[model samples]
Every structure is written in structure tokens, then in C-alpha cells.
Target: MSDKKKEIDLEEIIAKYRPVVGFRVKKSLGAANPDWEDVANEIMLNVVEKIKKGEFRGESSIGTFIYTITSRRIVDYIRQKSKVLRHAPEPKPLPSPHEQIEDKERAELIAGAIKKLKPKYRETLYLYYYRDLSRKEVAQKLGISLRRVSERVNYSQKLLRKLIKK
Candidate 1:
């Protein structure tokens, strides 16, 4: 797009800097990584725009200016690629119908086991395991002592195992 901006002699700049910029990009980023033509074109466009806008003040030689732009672009490209690789999302697996069925059956079995439990044991199991509450939290919620909550949870697990086995 900047090539269409007719303020500077783009052809002269391309002729002088294409080889230097292209070679630098290929050598630094490896020829196998990206198309050399694309890198060369980007460098040419940037240099042309910078010179036109007076950003490339006469403090540095033309070669140094071209090299700086080329090197910075290459570095930026690599950093962007590295970030993409590092933060790439993990693939999620879909559950098979068989797995879903088995999970449902397991939930039904646990529900039946919990239903068979006495009220105190059922309350303990529901709060401590199903609701994922800590023993102290369960005790506070049920207005019971911490030791009583712990005892109930231990007894409820044993009772649940026996009920599920049947």
C-alpha cells in the first residue's frame, strides 16, 4: 500500500537495498522459514516510507538504515511466532457416547446409594463429598461439632461403599 504513495523514488531504493535486506532476512531467519521476496518487499516499503517521512534522517548511511529496518523486522517476526507457539490453546476432546452413558450410570448408582443412606449419613455425605464442603464448613452448616462431622463422614463413606456394592 505504501508503494502507491508517490512521494519517494521507491524503485531506486529497491534496487539499492533489496539484495542487502533480502540476504540479511534469509541469513538471520533462515531461508526455509519465510519467503525471501516477502521479507525484501516489507523492508523496501518501510525504508521508502521512512525516507519519505524524514524518519531516516541523514545521520546514518543508507546501508545502515536498511540493515536496521531489516533486522528489527526479522526480530519482531520471530518474537510474534514465539508468542503464538507459547500461548497456543490446548485441544479439547469430545466425550464418546459410550463414555457419556457410563458416566450417567455411575451417577445413578451413587444417587441410589445416597438415597439408601440414613438421614444423618446422607446429610454428612452430601455436605462433605457431594457439595465439596470442608469438615469445618459442614459442621458449621449442620450445627454439629467438628469431631462429630468427621465421624459422620467416615461412617457415611463405609456405609455408602456397602450400599453401592449391593
Candidate 2:
């Protein structure tokens, strides 16, 4: 039938589909995004290209095909935006003067707590943490079993945390 075999006219397609596509884009990608208009334009361009390439087979109505394309493009746009957000470098502004003072005070408090620990607990923490030795290495250096080394490290941390909380 000539009706089913009708030519794909992009202008008519745009006129009919623009509102729905724009609505879907705005809904899927929040209005807060400055690039929402660019995304809608990309979707329109893709729809035009696909039509010119004869990708529309008429197995479905033009409205359904356009709807599918619009939905997928919106998803792609959302995913791309999220991906940028996920990997974007966090801004590291300079710490304020009060923050610097607090950091110095906290370091002094922690150092005091470390000094109060028993010699073995203190040395084990130094070797494992300050020297960045593996538990096995610390055990070997300290002439103790791996389990003993682990216990001392854990117990020392717990004691330090309790002491610091005072």
C-alpha cells in the first residue's frame, strides 16, 4: 500500500516528534543541566540521519520509532553526564586557618597517645604503620609470631582510640 510505503520526510517527522522528544529529554535530564538544549539537538540530528539512511523499515509507526530513538538518546545522554561526574576531579581548595590549627592540635594529641602506649605496642605500630612493613615482616623483625603481632597491633589501636577519646 502507498500509505505504508510513504517516503520518510524529516521536516514532518521533526514537527510531529520535537515536543515529545524535548519533554522526554527535559524529564530524563534535569532542567538544571546547562547542556540540555544541546542534547535535544543531538537527538534531533540522530533522528534525521537515521531517516536519511533509510533505517526506518515501517515495521512500526514513525511515532514509535522516533519514541524509541528519543528514549535511547536520553539514556545515553544521562549515562555520559553521570560518567563525567563519577570521574571528575574533586576540587581541593586551601584549608582555612582554623582547620590548619585543628589539624596541628589533633596531630599533637595523637602523638601523646602513642607515647603512652606500652613499648611493644608502640614499636609494633611504628614498624607496621610508620615503616609500612607487612605483618609478616613486622613479626620477623619483632621476633614474634604473626598472630602475636596482629593482636598487639589491634589492641594498641583500640587503646589509643580509647585514650584519645578522653
Candidate 3:
């Protein structure tokens, strides 16, 4: 049979099990969250897509597979929502002029110490820490290996500490 025919058949099977699996997963999530139908639809969609991609290795029963995927998807949803809620920033009072001036001086001192570093160390620090690039990204940008970037960052920190202590 053609792949399309297989997909339609599989989809029908999934639909047959949807209500039972959806009810089980939804009950675990309690009330006041996404509706059961929506969660079930998303779980079915995910399973279907994974099936199409040949990601189902057939190491587990179909029911077990559905249960694991549904559980993980629900956990992922909770984590995503919790992340946003946990990171919600509260307002803070502005710093005083004296505090601002002190911060500026500290930044200037740090900059001067950075300047004293060798070019390799300086550029690595600037890109990885100042620019907030990941180590892999820094390696790509600087044409170096991930290990080399890590070495540079570590050595630069030590060198900067020595320089700043003077």
C-alpha cells in the first residue's frame, strides 16, 4: 500500500483510542487548564507527525507509546506556563545618582582590565561573556573549537582577575 493509505488507516486507529487516552491524560492535569479535546488533538497530531518521520521505533506497545507521549506533552505545557509565570519581573525603584556613578566606575575598571588581556583572550571574553554568545556560538564566530573557546574563557577569567587585583 502507498504511504498515504497507511497514514489514513493509522489516523483512524488513533481516533478510536483518542477519547480514552485523552480522558486519562486530562484527568491527571486537573481542571482550569486546556480542554481535554484540545490536549487529545495535540497529542494525536504529535504522534502522527512522529510516525511520519519514522521516529516510532516500535520498542513499546501502541497504548504505552500514546500514554508516554501524552504525559510528556502535558508536562511540557505545564513547564512552559510555569517558566513565564516564574520569570515575571516585579518593578524596582531606580538607583540613586551616586550608585549609578559607582556602577559606571566599576564598568570602566572592568573595561580597562579587559583591554590589558592578549587579543585572543580579550576577543573570547568579549564575545562569550559580553556578547552573551554560547560557547558553541563563540567557537563558530571565532573559527575555533568548542574546547578552545572554553580554554580561552577560563584563562581569560584568571588573567582578568590578576589584572584587576593590581
Candidate 4:
């Protein structure tokens, strides 16, 4: 076997997919945080390296591959953030009662409802709502069929509504 590496045009690929990858990363990370662009660049670099190493295997389009990598990178970033929070100093106390009664009460109610959902339903809901993934993309990420993804999303939404009603 020859040792020649498949020469991919990294610049061309980057030019074509950088925006898409950045969009994916930004959507995956909730709009509350910074560093999404940096994460996108890191994901793109890793994807380029994987392509040159022949690890991509053309199972999906380069765009799809980049999206997948960016999604995982966002998840990794969140995990790292949680880890850092665990090691950091305790946060300061909350504001006064008058300030706390604004939108935070409604937000907490919704969050509690979501947490009460079944695991699979919660995962599907989070991927759809928080990650902003399409049904097909959710299927691809979760390794389920597109039809199943659609069904699960609909079912999960119903469950969420019921949970919130109680």
C-alpha cells in the first residue's frame, strides 16, 4: 500500500463550510454564552485533520460531518464549563425578593417541568429546542430513524404540555 496522503484543499473546504459550521455551533450553544466562534474554528481544524487522515470515510457530506463535529464540540464545551463551575468559588447570593420575582419565577417553572420529563423525551426535547436541530439532524445525531425522531419530538411535546399543565 502506498503511503501517499489524500491531499484535501483545506482552504477551499474552510471557505465553503466555515459559515455553516459557525452557524451550527452558535445554534447548539444556547445564546447566553460567548466563545462559539472559537469552538467552531477548533471543530473545523479537527475536521480538516480527520479528512486528511482518511477518517471521514465519506459517510456523510463534508457539511454534515462538520455540523456533527461542531455539535459535539459544543457539548464538550458545556461539560467543561460545568466542570469548571464545580471547581470554582461559590457564587454570590441572589438578589432581593422583589428583584427575584420577575421573569425568573416563570423560567424556573418551565425548567422544572422539563426536568420532570422522561430521559428519552427530555433528550429529544433539548436537542430540538435548545440545540435547534431539525428532525433529520436529530435523527442523525441520536442514531435513530427520521420518522422516529419526528414521532419522538411530537410525543415529547405532548408530554411536556401535560407535565406543565399539572
Considering every candidate listed, which one attains the maximal TM-score?
Answer: 2
- Which tens-of-lDDT digit does each residue in 24-105 have in candidate 3? 7678665434445677788888888777777776789777877798889888877775787688843544446897799889
The lDDT per prediction is 0.80, 0.83, 0.80, 0.78
Candidate 4, residue 13: the lDDT equals 84
Compared with the true structure, what per-residue lDDT tens digits does model 4 show for residues 130-166? Answer: 9999988888888899889889878877876787788
* Winning candidate number (lDDT): 2
Candidate 1 local lDDT, 111-145, one digit each (tens): 88889889988888888888999989999999999
RMSD of 1: 23.0
Which candidate do you rate higher for lDDT, 2 or 4? Answer: 2
Model 1 has an lDDT value of 0.80
Measured by TM-score, how close is model 3 to the native structure? 0.44
The superposed Cα distance between candidate 2 and the true structure at residue 61, in angstroms, equals 0.9
* Candidate 2: stretches off by over 4 Å: 1-8, 89-166
Task: Write candidate 2's Cα lDDT for 109-155 as tens digits.
Answer: 99999999999999999999999999999999999999999899889
Error of 3 at 28 (Å): 2.3
In model 3, which regions exceed 4 Å deviation?
Answer: 1-5, 86-166
